[model samples]
Target: MRPYNFSAGPAVLPESVLRTAQQDMLDYNGTGFSVMEMSHRSDMFHSILYHAEQDLRQLLAIPSNYKVLFLQGGASAHFTQIALNFANGFKRIDSVVTGNWSGIAHSQMGKLSDVKVHLAAHGGDLYHYNDLPPASQWDISPDSAFVHYVINETVHGLQYRDIPQLGKDAPPVICDMSSEILSRRINVADFGVIYAGAQKNVGPSGATIVIIREDLLGRCSERVPNVWNYQKHIEKDGMYNTPATYPIYMAGLVFRWLQTQGGVAQMEKINTLKAQTLYDAIDGSGGFYRNPIQPQARSYMNVIFTTGDKTLDERFIEQAAVRGLMFLRGYPVLGGMRASIYNAMPLAGVEALVAFMAGFQRRYG
Candidate 1:
């Protein structure tokens, strides 16, 4: 049996998707060439791209007004690209710093000399990165170009259970959903832009998915190069440059797999159960295991916890690896254990981890 992988990105993929890719590695659909070797301009690849978008639209119920662009450069690259494109003609942008990724994005936007970066809200101030502050307390500037926030923080394992409801006159809301995209249902029309790195729930590391409202497309600054401009890529149907062809194709297959599993709604239900199973195990362990984040803010995708004993935590990780529960070590900045249960992870995998946790506690606790 294959060990259940729990690494955060370039993470675990569905067994069936891997099997399909394995079968197509040499020749995809009898095209006499691997998807890796095919021309991006060819009709076969175009068909793959078209179906991928359509399937994703169906899954998310994405509005017609939103243009989905599959582009190169990880979501991190877009931190500056977003400012170049949207922060034009404005003095400042509001950024809510809830965790590491948002903090990085906030800092990246500050690098642009033209626009000032405003801290709209920060969770670390009061919650110490354990929970989010109430949205009502966000210090949003009325004239800011856009409001930036992260829907989920992968490292800190904090997730926003409720969407922020900025008033009608507020600036556009741009979100980084790298860790939790496609894991649940979201109102596509709620934000002006949403971007995610495909490594987690989507497909792989090379492809970045940006869903931008049509009206926001024209906001790119003239000084911005074609490569960094959202409008330029959208004008060419996201083919301005030779895109990440194989990663896009892999993402297309993942979309089809999501459809077969009854789309995001059903996946959300399963994800909820999987997360609850693990969280419950942690909570029920008395003082043996503990998760610091507030229950409401805990991520359904990444569960972070610890025994409060460094030696025990290390021993748990070591023994769990032997039991096929791999990559259970937490982020270095936050030393503990993290079980990232993306959509591709089966409930059985999480159950296996929980069982191991119970056995470990029994042996050591």
Candidate 2:
């Protein structure tokens, strides 16, 4: 049997998408060349790119005013791109530090001498990963370029349940939804830019999706590189440079696969069920397993818990691997176990993990 892979990312992809890619390895759509072998500028490749964007738009209900750019850099690079693009005129960029990803972005923004960064709302030193600070307390400045926030923190297993209310006349919200984008529905209008690293839920590494409001494109200063300029990429239809062709093609396949599964609403329902089942297993373990994240803030896609003993945690991971469940190890920072159940992870996989958890607890408890 194929093992259930729970690596944070470059994670699981849809089985059907993999099978389709395998079938198309030699010839795609009756063309004598594989998608990877075809020229990026070819009419056939153009169609592929076009349909992919359109399908994604339909799935997310992205507004006509928003531009979706499939860029080359990973999500981490966006921490700099966002500031470089939007922090030119504004005195400050307000960022909410909820967990690891947002904290990194906030720290990066602070290093830009031209841009003053405001920590609008932070989980603080004590409660950094357990819960999100209330948005009402955020000190977002109206004149700030953007109020950046992370929708999900992969390592900490924390997530925001709804769009944050950052107060009236607040700057446009920028979100790093890298880990949770398509797992649920989100209002595109609520954000000035919504960016995600494609490795989780989308397709794979090397491609990042950036959906930005039209007006935000040309806000970059002259110091920003041409390749890093959102306006330049927009003018070029996200093809200014040689794009990650295979990753984008795979993303298109993943998006099409999402359509067949009844879209994001269905995905949200299934994802919620999976998280709840796994969390329930942890909660019901009678202290054998403990998830540090608060109930409301817990991520539906990544579940982190521990048996509270490092040696036993090691044992659980080893035994689970032996049972064909793989990459159950936790992030070094978190120091526990994590089961990252992205969109491609079916409920059956979660059930299998829950069963494993129960059996492990019985043996080790």
Candidate 3:
């Protein structure tokens, strides 16, 4: 049997999606060529791409004014592309430096263009990564092009329970929702741009799904590369060049699977139960297994915990692997243990992890 995977991105996908892909591997739609070998410009591919976009829009309740573009380069590439597209005419871009991903975006924006990047509200040592500062602490510029934040940080186990409220005349809010998208319901109208690498909750690593407000298009500077221009991609129907065809098809299958499971609202409920089951295991351990993140800020998607003893942490990971749990090691920066429970991770997986933690604590604590 395949082990339960818990890696951060390029993470688990629904079993049903995998089975469908396997069945269609050789001949897709009675066509002689496999989906991997088919010409992207063919009518079959167009139908695949069209239905994928439509299903995603319906799943997310994406506004008619928004444009969904599936592209390459993942979320990291968009860090530079975002500045190129949105930061041209504006004087500054405000960013919240909460964790690794958002911090990376903030730093890259400063180097990518002429826009004066503002570190709106950085969490200091006292509250770093484990908690989010109050919205009142943000030093947002009224004239900035946009305010950026990550909805969830996979490494540090931090998540924003609600969208941060900006000032009355605050600039548009841009989010890098790489790890959290599709795991729950969200207001698509609340942000100017929502981008996520299609790895964790969506599909595989090749495609980056971007949903941008219509008004945000056509704002790319002339100096911006054609490949990175959002307006150009929109004009070309997300097919300006060869897209990540297989990954897009895979994402479409996953979207259809999510629809069968009652969409994101049902996903949110299952995700909550899965996260709470693991969190309860940690909390009930009586300081044996501890998660540093505050209760409210803890991420439902990525759970990071510690054994208080480094050797015990190491031993737990090693032993868990022997029993079939995989990739339970924490990120090097966090230095303990992490379990990334994306939408594809079922409650049974979380239950198994919790049971292993309990048994390990009994043996080692």
Cα error, residue 262 of model 2, in Å, equals 0.5
Clashing pairs in 3: none
Clashes of 2: 0
TM-scores for all predictions: 0.99, 0.97, 0.98
Pairing residues by index, what is the TM-score of model 3? 0.98
Q: Cα lDDT for residue 354, model 3?
A: 91
Q: What lDDT is obtained when candidate 2 is compared to the true structure?
A: 0.89
What lDDT, from 0 to 1, does candidate 3 have? 0.90
Residue range 1-365, candidate 2, lDDT tens digits: 57898989989998999999999989999997899898889898888889989999999999999999899889988998899898887789988998888889998875654888888888856486698776787888788999999988898898887668765698989999999988999889988999999999999898999999988876866677889888888888888988998899999999999999999999999999999999999999888899878898899888999999999999989999998889989999878799999999988888988888888877767
Among these predicted structures, which one has the highest lDDT? 1
Candidate 1: tens digits of C-alpha lDDT, residues 1-365: 89999999889999899999999999899987799999999999999999999998999999999999999899999898899999888899999999999999999986865799999899999789999977798899879999999999999999998888888988999999999999999998899999999999999789999999999877886688999999999999989999999999999999999999999999999999999999999999997999999999999998999999999899999999999999999999999999999999999999999999898999998
Per-residue lDDT of model 3, residues 1-365, tens digit only: 77889888789998989999998999897996789998899999999999999999999999899999999999999887898998888889988888888888888986768788888888644496679876788888778999988989888899988777775788888999999999888999888999999999999999999999988786776687788899888889988999999999999999999999999999999999999999999999999999988899999999999998889899999999998899999999778999999999988888889999989988988
For each candidate, C-alpha RMSD in Å?
0.8, 1.2, 1.1
Descending-TM-score candidate ranking: 1, 3, 2
Worst 10 residues of 1 by lDDT: 109-118
